[model samples]
Target: MSKIGNDHLTETRDHLINEIDSLSESQLNWKSNLESWSIAQVCHHLVLVEESTIKAIAWGVKAGEPTQSERKKVEQHILDRTKKIIAPKIVEPDTKLFEMQQIKDLLNDSRIKLHSLLSTVEDKSMLAKKSVKHPALGELRLDQWIEQIYLHEQRHIEQIKEIRSLYEELTEAFSSDHIQ
Candidate 1:
């Protein structure tokens, strides 16, 4: 992966950390609606995603070869928020609640593992020599998989913001109810 890609990944990670750090335990676990995921769930889902993506990419790099394709363009599709898709069940977050610190630790560990693996690569071209399968996007080489990881986190960052808004609204409403 390119240095810029790594920078983007770290930037998104920092943003996620900041966003979660600002929430209280109740806010982290609050759901805006019956169908929406709590911020904690979103963080847990991201942890699962990064862990799985890195593992799959590492395995593919060791055991397989990349296929010819426009990986960059295909991976860019993941950044489009208007295009909604379901996540594979294997990567789904646990329904159990998570503490903010626990989520932070998982994210931090995952980042370290990923950065360590990618940093060991002396030739960027080698990324193209291997590929992994994304449940929704199908086959993606290492570079594309890296890009998708960031894009996926970004999508959830937006979700986190929405959850923040909902939490604020709910808190305001509850506070008002006791004002009289």
Candidate 2:
């Protein structure tokens, strides 16, 4: 049961925070296509992933029985959903506030909360122990889960950059029309 380093989680959080800070408002709301989700939706999806992970962690703490496959599935689900959110076909663009300026702050909030929870846990010992057994991945140590978490965020950041580029290209066309 190899445990993950405490610092790894912190580092991953920092990288994600930086990624979120790089986007502008239009980029946050821009959908790449009619079937894709906007950058704002990507943020919202992350919130869901966190919520689900918290639930899985809680379950692991109590029962210690989610199977390795189940744990792997959990991590993969987070990854897939995040990818979908950041790179989905542009669904009908909805009317709403994107407020991407606040993403940096939000990521900060996420870090604070995650660290607080990690610090309070008496089961750091269990970090290496199988708190939950996944159905396929078997039982993963905390370190493995943390690694997956970083990769999941990496996918989204990549998508965020892509979304920003698309926004730029499309808006350039609009600006050109105005210039003419």
Candidate 3:
């Protein structure tokens, strides 16, 4: 396993775990607007994306041909706060709001699968092979895909925080009205 890749996966997983731990069930289900995802939905989406992307990476590796396009260094552009990319319909969150424990279990299971895949790579250089075609980003290697998963989690961290902020605002307003 690439220590760096595993480290990133672990770090992002922990950060997500901590972020959602304090939120109440109502907060988790709250959306800032009709168009936005709730915290629960975002968490669910992360689980879906991580699992599918890992599978795609594994499938690409087994298929075994280096991509024709020269692999450029994969940057963490997904983490950019200023830019927004539309999620492909395949990855859109399920309508049901998942329980917190269920979301955590799914996330952990996906991470374990990811670690297992990384362990099979004997040479770190295979990361540059660009073996898989991502729905949004086109061809990417296993390592880059792994990095993208973490970066995608980071992107949703901001959304989760925004959800929390809006939830807090609503709570405060309701509290003040009751007091009045």
Cα TM-score per model? 0.91, 0.68, 0.90
lDDT of each: 0.81, 0.58, 0.80
Best by lDDT: 1
> Cα miss at 144, model 2 (Å)?
3.0
Kindly give the stretch of ten consecutive residues in candidate 1 with the minimal lDDT sum. Answer: 63-72
Candidate 2, residue 52: lDDT: 45
Q: How high is the lDDT of residue 34 in model 3?
A: 85
Clashing pairs in 1: none
Off by over 4 Å in 3: 72-76
Per candidate, the number of residue pairs that clash is 0, 25, 0
Runs in model 2 with CA error above 4 Å?
Answer: 1-5, 64-96, 131-142
lDDT of 3 by residue, 21-100 (tens): 98878888888778989999999899889889878877867776666555535555677768778888878898777678
Better of 1 and 2 by TM-score: 1
